[model samples]
Target: KEYNVAILGATGAVGTRLMQKLAESNIPVKSLKLLASKRSAGKKLKYRDDVLTVEEATPDSFDGVDLVLASAGGAVSKKLLPEAVKRGAVAVDNTSAFRMDPDVPLVVPEVNPDALENHHGIIANPNCSTIQMVVALEPIRKQFGLKQIIVSTYQAASGAGQSGLDELRDEAQEHLDGKKMDAHIFPVKGEKEHYPLAFNLLPQIDVFEKDGYTHEEWKMIHETKKIMLNDMNSGAIKVTATCVRVPVEICHGESVYFTVDDAKDASREKIQSILNDAPGVTLKDDPKKQLYPQPIDAAGKEDTYVGRVRPDQENDNAYNMWVVADNLLKGAALNTVEIGEELVKRDLI
Candidate 1:
C-alpha cells in the first residue's frame, strides 16, 4: 500500500536524515509532506527528484497524511503528536516526549517489534544510545537471559542535534587558532553553563537532576528497562549508565558490561556466535587484526555494530562488549522508520 507521509521537524538534523531515509525507502509513497517550525517554513527540501516545501507544523498539517514521522523536539512533539493521531495518522515519534508514557510503546523493532502491535496510533523511537545497545544485547538476553548491564557511552555531538555538531566544529577551529573556544550547546544548552567538546570529554549529556544523574544517563537506565520489559519479580535486567559526550561527530559508541543468568559454562565465543547472526547487528571483532567497531566506520550505517567481546575477569557470568551506531540513523531516523515498517507489516497502521 502507498502511504502519504509527513515529516515533522523536517529541517533539523534527524528530521533531514528521516526525509532522506524515506526517499530511499522501499515503502511505496503517494505523497511526502515536510513540516517544521515557522522559522524553517517555505524551505525547499529535495527528495527523489521532487522539491517539497517545509510547512509550519500545526494541527492542520496532518489533514491527509497517513504516516507522520516526527523528529521535532519534545515540546513540539507533545503538542503535535496527538493532533496527528486524532487526524488518523500513525505517528512514529523520534523524541522522548511520549516514550515513557504507558500508553505509548517505546520500540526498537529489532528488540521488540511486538510492541508495535499495541500502538494507539503512536510509536516511540528509543534513545539513540539505548537503541543500539538494546539491539546488540537483546538476542543474547533472549538466549542466555540478561541479569545486569553497565554501560559507559562515548557519544557523538550529533546526538545533541545540529547545534551540537556546529559547537564541536567551531570549538575545534577556535582551539587551532590558539583562541578560547565558546560553548553554547554541548552537555546541555539551556542549562546555566556550557563546556567545550573539542578534544575533550564531558561526563554529562543532558542536565543533571537532583538525583545526581544527568537526564541522558537516566534515559539510558529507564529506557533500557522499558524496552527490555524486564520482569521485576523474575530478576530481570538491571541497567546502569554513565553517558558522556566526546569529540566525535556522528556515531555513538558504548562500552557495555553485562551478566547473564545462564550456566557458568557460557563462553565469550558462544556469545560472539549468538551476536554474529543477530538481526540489525554487525559483529566486527578481530583483535588479531586490530579491528573493531569505530564511529567513523559506523557513521551513515543502519545496523548496530558490536565488538570487543570478552569475559569480565571478576564475574563468572559477566561479559564485556562494545556497541556503536550512527546516532542519527539507527539511533533516530532508521529506528522510527523501522517502527513504521513494523506497523505496516503487522497491519497495525
Candidate 2:
C-alpha cells in the first residue's frame, strides 16, 4: 500500500505545508520528493525528523512518483501535471489550471470526496476560499438543499502565497516605524497597481475579468456549482462572491448568506443544529459570550470554523453565518493531502 509521492513547488507556502501534512499523514508514503524551481533547488525542507533536498521540477521529475501533490502556480501545473500523469502518477493539482476541466475533478475531500471517483489522472483542489465555504456549505446543502449562496471572502495574505505574507510583515514594521510602506506582491503580482495589506484591505484578489468580477470571485461562483451539483439539471444553484484580501496572516474568513430550497428548514436552530454535527466543521456561535469564528483562532487548524448562524430577517428563507479556516491547511495543502489520503482509503492508488 505504500506509495512514492512527489510534492511540486515544495518550497513555497502551500508546498511547505503540504510536506508537513504528508509527513504527518497516515497515507503510506514509501518515499518523498520535493520539487521546486531551479532557484530553490538544493534547498533542504523538513518533513518529520528528516530533511529532504528539493530538486528542480521538470518533466523528468516524475520518474517513479505514484502521486504528485502540485501546489505550484497554474502555469507550472499546466506545464507539469500532464507530464506527471503521463508517467503513471495521479496528480492532485492545487491550481486553477484544470479545476473546471471536464477531465479533472475539483475536490474538497470533506465536501466532494466522491468526485475523486471520476479522476482521470488529475484531481484539482478547489480555491482556498471556495474550499472552506463549500465544506461549511456541504452539510447545510445536504440537510436543506441549497438554492443560493452569496459570499464575501476576507482572505488572508497567505492566499497569495509566500511573497504576500512577506509583504504584510514588512509593511507592518515599516508602518510602525513611520517609514514609507512599499506596496508590492498583492492584488495582482505583475500588474501596475499594488496595495499594502498590513493594516488595510483590498477588495480584490485576482485579475478583473471583463464582467468586473475578479478571477477569485468567479472561481468561488463556478467552483461551488461544479462541486455541489453532480446532476446537470440541478446545477443551476445561484452563487455570487466578492473576494477580498484582509490583514490576517493565516486563516481566511468568510461571511456567507445562503437560501435553501426548503424554506421551512431554514430556522436558526435547525441550521446551527445541522452544522453542529457536520463533518470537518466546528460550530462556535455564542454571541452572549462574544464568541465566534475568528482568523486568529482558526489559524493552524484543519477544521472549518462556522459561527454567526442566524435566520436573515429580511428574507425568511435566507440564513447567514461566518466561516474560517487556515488558508494553508483545509484550504490548500492539507486538503490536497487529504484527497490523496482518501484515494489511499479507497485503494485508488
TM-scores, each model vs. reference: 0.97, 0.97
In TM-score terms, candidate 2 sits at 0.97
> Which ranges in model 2 have alpha carbons more than 4 Å from their true place?
231-235
Best by lDDT: 2
Candidate 1: the clashing residue pairs are none
- Tens-place lDDT per residue, model 1, 217-249, is 888888888888832123367788999999999
RMSD of each: 1.4, 1.4
Count clashing residue pairs per candidate. Answer: 0, 0
